[model samples]
Target: MTSTDHDTAPADRTAAGTAPAPAAPARRPRRELAAATVGSVVEAYDWTIYGILAPYFAEQLFPGSSPTAKLLAAYLGFALGFLVRPLGSVLIGRLTDTRGRRYGLTLTVSLIAVGSLLLAVVPGYASIGLAAPLLVVAARLVQGLSVGAENPSVAAYVTETAPGRHRYFYSAVSYGGVVLGSALSFIVLSVLLGVFGESGIENGAWRYGFLFGALLGLTALWIRRGAQESAVFTAAAPGADPAPGPDGAPGKPGGTGGTGPAGAKRAKAPSPWPVLRAHLRRLTVVFAITSGATTAFYFVTVDFPSYAEGTGAATKEESSAALLLGMVALLLAMLGGGRVADRFGALPVLRVGFAGLALGTVPLVLAMSSGRVPVQLVPAVLLFLLGLPLAVSNVFAGQLFPPAVRAVAVGLPTAVAISLFGGTFPMLAELLRSAGHNDWVPWWPAITAAAALAASWGVREHPLPGEPHA
Candidate 1:
């Protein structure tokens, strides 16, 4: 028996009295993939837009501070937003796990749109004085909460809806959305810089960028409003599915006994704590598995450009160009990671991805630090690409839990790790670079990847605890 099944010695007998649910409709697997991608692109775009525009906004908002201190302050606000993610996970996770994925995802998209709008409209410090930075902090906090809910909801939906054969490829869209989002943002920034010049960008073009995010967030929200509810959760919810019939076949879809009042079953909203408690070890392992990923993504996508520019390794123009290159490589790595996971099993992909990071990150950082376009784009970029663990990570995490607590199960620890590591990535990278230890940058992800490798031994693809061995 699974740990959740066996651990309830004093079982919550409420579900025992309820009937099992009928078979659900054939899952629209592509809809799950599309909805997940659409919603997450907005989440990723909203979050990373800050990192892309940080250098400019830091000047606009925190005018008098030294460049390093300003970056530190901006990242501090970024980190502060992440600090609230655990709370968001608890709240949003419970909502999705209990109410429905559609509810949780829709809420997440709304928050993203609002957060982006806030940043778009909030006045600069020169006009509003102290309130300017405070407003930005508030905006980040909203965006942070949206992100906390977004990743797990997308992963959980993809996992539950996809057929076992194609789960990895579809689930990879979780991170693929991130890659696409950041890529779009960078491309926009490059165009703005080219057309408007630096002063124009800092003054007005940046506002337009956030406005674009706000509009996209609205589009995602509308799309997700119609997202198909999770069939697993639908069947599990109390009233939605009926008990088995006498012949051993289960009741018809949406319960048995026709539409009469006699067939009504109450929907039992799931509680998060017991589910998490039952799977604590798995939860811990999930956290470890994601630590390297969370750190590596933020490190390469968010921190690397600032580090290169700050260290005199590259000019602002060169750093942006290099980031564009790395993002393209990220897209390739995402595809490769998913394909590898589907063919070989997610564990092997996870191991290989982690191994690549552990072995090559230092050299990659060293090469990027030199700022030569060729050196940065060559095989060194491949190492960062390997760090695209979201595909493997999402697939692995999706199969590890049942749908009841899946969102929170995946989101809680992911939030904790990202809050701890991802949030601090830019600050830490900038701090280390400022301290003249540019070489140390690679070791952060290297250490995390090694730890994740050890943790991968504990991951399994089955919904049940031990039926299918890792």
Candidate 2:
């Protein structure tokens, strides 16, 4: 057949002939990924600081109460942020799918910055009585909305920018951002507590952590400023009367391919709700497994620090050292995990990671509880290491859907799962111990890891960034 004939041939026919040239290489997409990673890490640093400092914040804000009651209140406030996050995802995900990632991200981070600023200045319970906790809860809700909105945009942006072969590795950076942020919070608190002492932490050092959060939000805004709309998003065709942002400006040009005037509209895919319905079976798998995975990791990273100190497994000093070391390990593991996903694809890496996380969690926690000189540290480091599977899963999650619904696909379900599992995990652990089930706590991670493995198994080995289906 003539060359022209070959171009128009069916897929089977085309395979019999020479294939088309591969698409052009993505241009410095990793730079965009790096910026997104940095912004996310900064935001996480601010958000997680509350979790790390919960014990102190509890003492200061809810004095004259039982220790359990005080800590429980602080955690409940933290969980409140997760509760409102899904609503933010629904609101913002639609905007992201219809508008553009850049606009959605900008709006989200702006809200986070404002919320953190409020938390920094808000009065304690001593000063404001009933209003203090109320305000804290309200501020977290605001923070939740911003956080909910931010993830989907970042997920879409990174997935779109990543090169095909290396996409999973680049995608893993989102989770890496979480790990980095948690590490930073732990290290910073350790230093403040070690140098300034608990008296100092309660008096003013804790406030500094919140102030750092505000600064980080500002930094996220700054880094985001230099980002160009992704090539994939720019490629999407805008529809008529395209959704507008809070400002009068029109949303992003069609995500498919059209950058017109301020009010430009291009043809694009339908909303995510329809797609989600069509793929409910697959979506369920994504949500269930991912939820468990996220819960397990958050349990280890966020809850473990508080648990360690509260349970007397380690001194405040010892807990801080363990956390800091674990953070370093997590950083190394994430970077390495990303690269591994690039080489082997996401599934294989995740399978191994999940199993490791499951088996490792119970033994690790038990060992840490043993209070041996070196073993106490082993569990924290192992916890970070165990999370490698879930981190790898995140990279695949980013690539699971087309750019049009990618944000909603990854963000909404994960948000819901996080809300149910991540938000309430600490409280549940506290309850478990209080109820005389301390030995059973390790089972939580084990169960979660198993669920994650199932999810990893269900995930398609190859995902298309702009393809018609997930």
- lDDT of all predictions: 0.73, 0.69
Who wins the TM-score comparison? 1
**Candidate 1 lDDT, 1-470, residue by residue in tens:** 12331111111224556763343333456766788898878888888888878877787776456876776787788898899888788788778776667678889989989999999898888999889889999999998888887888887777666556556777776668887888788887888898998888877678888899999999998887666666555555445433333443223333334332255555446466886798888998888877888787777777766666666676667766777777777777777778767776777667777877777777766765675445356333643455356666775786677777788888999899899988888888878887888778768987887888788777554432222311
Stretches off by above 4 angstroms in model 2 are 1-27, 240-251, 254-269, 309-312, 371-373, 463-470
Clashing pairs in 1: 19-243, 20-243, 239-265
> Among these predicted structures, which one has the highest lDDT?
1
Candidate 2: how large is its RMSD?
A: 6.6
- Write down the worst ten-residue block by lDDT for model 2: 4-13
lDDT tens digits, residues 285-403, model 2?
76776676767767766766556765568665666677677767766777787788677666776677777776777776776677643534654566555656645655466666766
Q: Candidate 1 overall Cα lDDT vs. reference?
A: 0.73
Instruction: Kindly state the number of residue pairs that clash in model 2.
Output: 14
